[model samples]
Target chain A: MRAIVWKSATVLILIYVAVMGFLGPVPEREILYETIRNLYFHVPMWFTMTAMFITSLVYSIKYLNTKQESYDVWAVEFANGGILFGFLGLTTGMIWAQFTWGAWWSFDPKQNGAAVTLLIYLAYMVLRNSITDSKSRAKVSAVYNIYAFAAMVPLIFILPRLTDSLHPGAEGNPAFSGYDLDGTMRLVFYPAVIGWIMLGVWIVSLRVRIRNIKDKMYESSL
Target chain B: MKAAYSALAFIALPLFTLAAKYEPVTWDKTFRESGKIFVVVAVVLLILLSVFGYLITQDRRISKIEKELKNK
Candidate 1:
């Protein structure tokens, strides 16, 4: 029943975001124009990615403490979901940048940081695949996941702020506050973030469950 | 649930008020004026709904498999 409720909430919130994102009033800016509407779709990608990565980090820590196979499954699947969302966020941001910032790849601090963070996560996947034994694979990958998440926070969140960046939320510029995201945009933006996060959690849960089932099948076969 | 109902009510109220208001910005007024923008919204909504349908079906299928495995 709870699962159905969240699934319904995800659908309903996204439906609302889709409707309001297109027709809703936005700040009449000079360069942005209609593309300001991309805020609803673009920003949520990173939010969802970060949420997934954080969940992955938690499970990784849990795996380290308990050495449980299920925790390892949860960690890896959550990381996989995070990686998918991260790439989506990067690509969508590039598209938005091409229109507004006048280049597809602008070598912005935020862009570079995001690329590096994704590379770190990708390396985690490679590390997991290289190991043949299950126990060592889980331990090594769990440790790597923790470090990857640690690197990710500073790379994506902190480093971008230290340097001058075209992306929002720099030293003086703040995201979801000040002049950029006003009260009206919040109506859609907040819902969009929540909706996308819920969807990400749902996907990660499904993947984890499938991984568990696969493990069960393997055990029964053995 | 109550939040969803309130949001629906908010959406319903805005449909009428949206036509009466005008702003000084250049935001594809012609498309909006012609009511063709709703076509775009409709298309997006359709895609979203179909995606939800797929996810829900997948969820149900997985649940069925899990149940069968438990019974076995």
Candidate 2:
């Protein structure tokens, strides 16, 4: 019964967002119009990525404190989900950039920074694979996860500010202020973000459950 | 160590945001069309790569465990 309510609530929220997004009043200008549509997907992707990264970081810290393999597994699963969402965010951002900036990719600090952040996480995974001892792997990977998360800050935030970007809200660029979004648009945008974030958590939970099940099977076999 | 890394990353966000300046450029028609194609292809490739990578990782882990069990 609780599951039914939760499912129905999610469905209703999605429906509301869809209707508001499509029907909301937006500028008739082609660029603005198209970019507006991107808000529904692009912003949500970022939110989801942020959520997963935070989850990964939390588990990484927990593993470091407890020295438990389960925490390490949770961290890895969350990081995997984070990377998936990050890639989706990058793709969506690139699509928006192409239409708005007339380029597939720009060395814009933000763009390059995001790519570097992804690489750092990839390196963490590779490091995990290269290690053989279970305890050693967990310890080293947890350490790497912490480092990767730390590196993400400069890549995502610092480098972007030192240079110019085609993306909105850059230092010199005129960004969309609160006034830029009408109440109607906000109605859809905020809900979309929440819904997408919820979806991200759902994915992470499912992955963690699968990992736990697999671990159980492996242990039984042993 | 992971906490240190996370702290550094988080700290960099504000600085990066401060350094970034946004500049709007006029996009040409050809650029817009080609950009769309590029984005679509990139997205598809990313999805494919992720799926393939996951499968390979799963296969490698399963085989490694199987080998270990057999040896035992």
Candidate 3:
């Protein structure tokens, strides 16, 4: 019942965001103009990605402490979902930057950090794929996942804030300073974030369930 | 000639001032005015719907597999 409710809510909320995001009133700022709408779409991808990665980190810790295969599966699948959203965020950000910042790949601290973060997560996937033994693979990759996530937090959140960045919320940029996101914009922005995060969770759940079924079949075959 | 020149300059001064206020940014006022932005909204919504549809199908397929495994 709760699954159906939340799933339906996700659908409804996203549809609302899609329709309202384009039409919504935005702060008629100089550079952002219509592109401010990209906040609803682009920013949420990062929010969802961050949420997925955080979930993955928690599951990784759970797996390490409990030595449960299911926990490991949950960790990997959540990380997979995180990477998917992270790519979406990165590409959309690039496209937004192309028009607003006059270049596709500005050497902005945030952009560079986002790229490095994705590469680190990609390495996590590669590391998981390379290992052959199940137990050792789970244990080793869970540890690696912890380190990858730890590295990701600083690369994405910390270093970007410390340096001058083209992206908003940097040390010098008064981006998203209270007046930037007007009440009308936040009406759609918050819903968009929640909806996208819910969708990520849904996708991770599906992947985890499938992996569980596959593992069960393997065990039965033996 | 001097008086005519002064009158012409006085008339042109307000015209220059009326040209436009300095706006720091440009926004697509026409895009919203002509309602063409709705077309973009429709396109985005369609793509979102298709993705949701695909996910639904995948969900159903997985549910079917789960059922089959349970029955066995």
Candidate 4:
């Protein structure tokens, strides 16, 4: 019954998002109507990436507190999900950029910074694999996860603020204001974010369950 | 840990609210330029994600091998 309710809620939310996105408002004298559609895909990717990282950080702290293998598994799974969304976000953003910028790539601060942030997380996973001892693996990986997330702050937040960039919300860039967004756009945009986040959670939940099942099978065989 | 959570909430809430307030300008020259940057970054990000996924699978394999050795 609970599962049905959750599924229905997700369906209804998706429907709402689709309607808003397709029939959303467009300001007069705009240049890229088709490019506007990227919002549904691009913005949600960032939301999912942020949510996944938070989940990973929480589980890392939990592992530190309890030293439990389960917590470590949860952290890794969430981290994996984070990287997936981060990549998707970057891809969609690139598609939008190509049509608008007339080039495939730019040395924008946000672009370079996010790339480095993704690499940090990748390095964390690599560090985990190189260790042979279970306890040592969890301990060192947890420590690295903590540090990587901390490093993300400067890359995503600080550096973007310091330099000029083609991306919005940078220094000297016009900040987003309420007047810029219409009520109709809000209708789709908000729900898109919520739906993507829920989907990310669902993915992480499945990964965690798979990890649990594999562990159980291995233990039984032993 | 609590501090970190609070800080994230503080930063994200305002930014989200601000993002909600404005409609993203579409079809502008600058918007298109930004979009191009987004694509290039995304491709690089995809490659990075694949690498991470590979590393994770390797970690699982190593863990399995270690467990097997202990059992033996």
Candidate 5:
């Protein structure tokens, strides 16, 4: 029941963001030009992906402490959602870069960092699938998930800011502060992050439910 | 080598012309040159939302079936 309301709200909020972002006023910087409006879609995907990964990390910690299989399942599914959003973030960022930087996949610090971050999580998936025992898989993958999230923090959030890159807020560059901070971009940006995160949760919830049912069916078969 | 040079020259001429014609494009003032973007965004977003709505309904339906299976 509550899920229904949450999903509805997510839909409405995203629609608002899409509508506003398309029509909203944004400053046309010399280099960025009209493509600066991509700020609405691209930035929010990282926010949503980071939020989901944090949830995944928390569940990984809980799984370690409680040794509950359900917590482990939740951790895996949350990571899955994070990975899915990360793909969206990377591809959208690439497209935006093509317009602004004259290349689709320039070796930007942020871009390389994001690729490495995705690779770390992909290794986590590989680790999970290689183990046959559910308990061992859960335990081992929980540890890897924690490490993956730790790497993600620096990879996506910190390293990009520390190094020189085309991305904003880096060593010498100004970020969203110029236009994004002052403009009505936030009116849509904030809700867009919230909406995308909620949608991620909705997706994870369905996957988790399906997994639980599959486990139940397997046990019954035994 | 001579034929390859001709092929290279053939490619280079059009490429240079294209590069010369390339201009930095900027979006026009909204509602003046193109408010049609709003229409396109609205149409696409509606389709995306409907698909999302279907996923929600599928989640509920699957949950119902799971409950019935568990009860048995």
Candidate 6:
């Protein structure tokens, strides 16, 4: 019953955001114009991704302490979901930038920082695959996951705020809040963030379940 | 016929309220200015649908594998 409600809520919220995001009224700023609607989709991807990465970091730390294989599986799956969200965020950002910033890859500080953060997480995955032994693999990857997440936090959240970034709410740019003072967009924006984070977690949970099943099968075979 | 138009009015009511919340000129320039935006909307819809479909199938496959393992 709880699961049904969760699933229904996730679906309903996403549908509402999708419909309302497109039709929603936005402040017609000079450059953003209609493209500001990308806020609902693009910005939330990063927020969702960041939350997933944080979950990965927690699970990684838990795995180190408890030495539980399930914890490692949870960590890896959350990272996988985060990486997927990162890619979606990057693509949508590029599309938005192409229209607003007049180029696909502008090498802005925020853009560069985002790319590096994604690379750090990608390296964590590659590190996981290098080891053959399951126990060692889990241990090494968990440590690396901790380090990668530490680096990612600074790269995405801190560095962007420190530099003059083309992205909004950066050193040189004003945030969406300045113009969107009416807060109508917040209606859909908050829902979009919640919906995306819920969906990302759902995906990570499914992946972890599959990994657990695979581990069981392997153990039985042995 | 009367009910249908009223239904339309009910739906459009919120949207109009949305428009009125912001300046008319700004709304006109952003939303009404571009028909091409619907193309972008179409693309986004397609991507979202495909993503949801993939997740559903992957979920089903995982559930099937888990069931098989359980029976064994």
Interface RMSD of 1: 1.6
lDDT (10s digit) by residue, model 3, range A113-137: 8899999999999999999998999
| Candidate 3, lDDT over the whole model | 0.89
TM-score of each: 0.89, 0.71, 0.90, 0.72, 0.86, 0.83
Per-residue accuracy of model 2 over A86-171 as CA lDDT, tens digit each? 99989988888888878879777788888889989988889999999989999989888888989997778666766667666566
Write down the lDDT of every candidate, Cα atoms only: 0.89, 0.72, 0.89, 0.74, 0.84, 0.84
Rank the models by lDDT, top first: 1, 3, 6, 5, 4, 2
The C-alpha local distance difference test score for the whole of candidate 6 amounts to 0.84
For candidate 5, give the lDDT of residue A164.
78
lDDT string, candidate 4, A125-199, tens digits? 899999989899999999999999999878977888788777766743222345444565666777888877876
Model 4 regions lying over 4 Å from their true place: A171-175, B1-72
**Candidate 4 vs. true structure, TM-score:** 0.72
Residue A187, model 4, lDDT = 68
Tens-place lDDT digits, model 6, residues A143-181: 999899889877877888887777877743335555643
- Compute the DockQ of candidate 3: 0.49
Candidate number with greatest TM-score = 3
Instruction: Evaluate model 2: give its TM-score.
Output: 0.71
Look at candidate 4 and tell me the lDDT of residue A103: 58
lDDT of 2 at A201: 62
- The TM-score-based order of candidates, best leading, equals 3, 1, 5, 6, 4, 2
State residue A28's C-alpha deviation in candidate 1, in Å: 0.7
In candidate 2 the C-alpha lDDT for residue A134 amounts to 88
Instruction: Please give the DockQ score of every candidate, comma-separated.
Output: 0.39, 0.03, 0.49, 0.05, 0.26, 0.28
**What would the DockQ be for model 2?**
0.03
Residue A87 shift from truth in candidate 6, angstroms: 1.2
Q: Residue A60, candidate 4: how far off, in angstroms? A: 0.3
Steric clash count of candidate 6: 0
TM-score of 3: 0.90
Model 3 residue runs over 4 Å out of place are A172-175, B1-21, B24-26
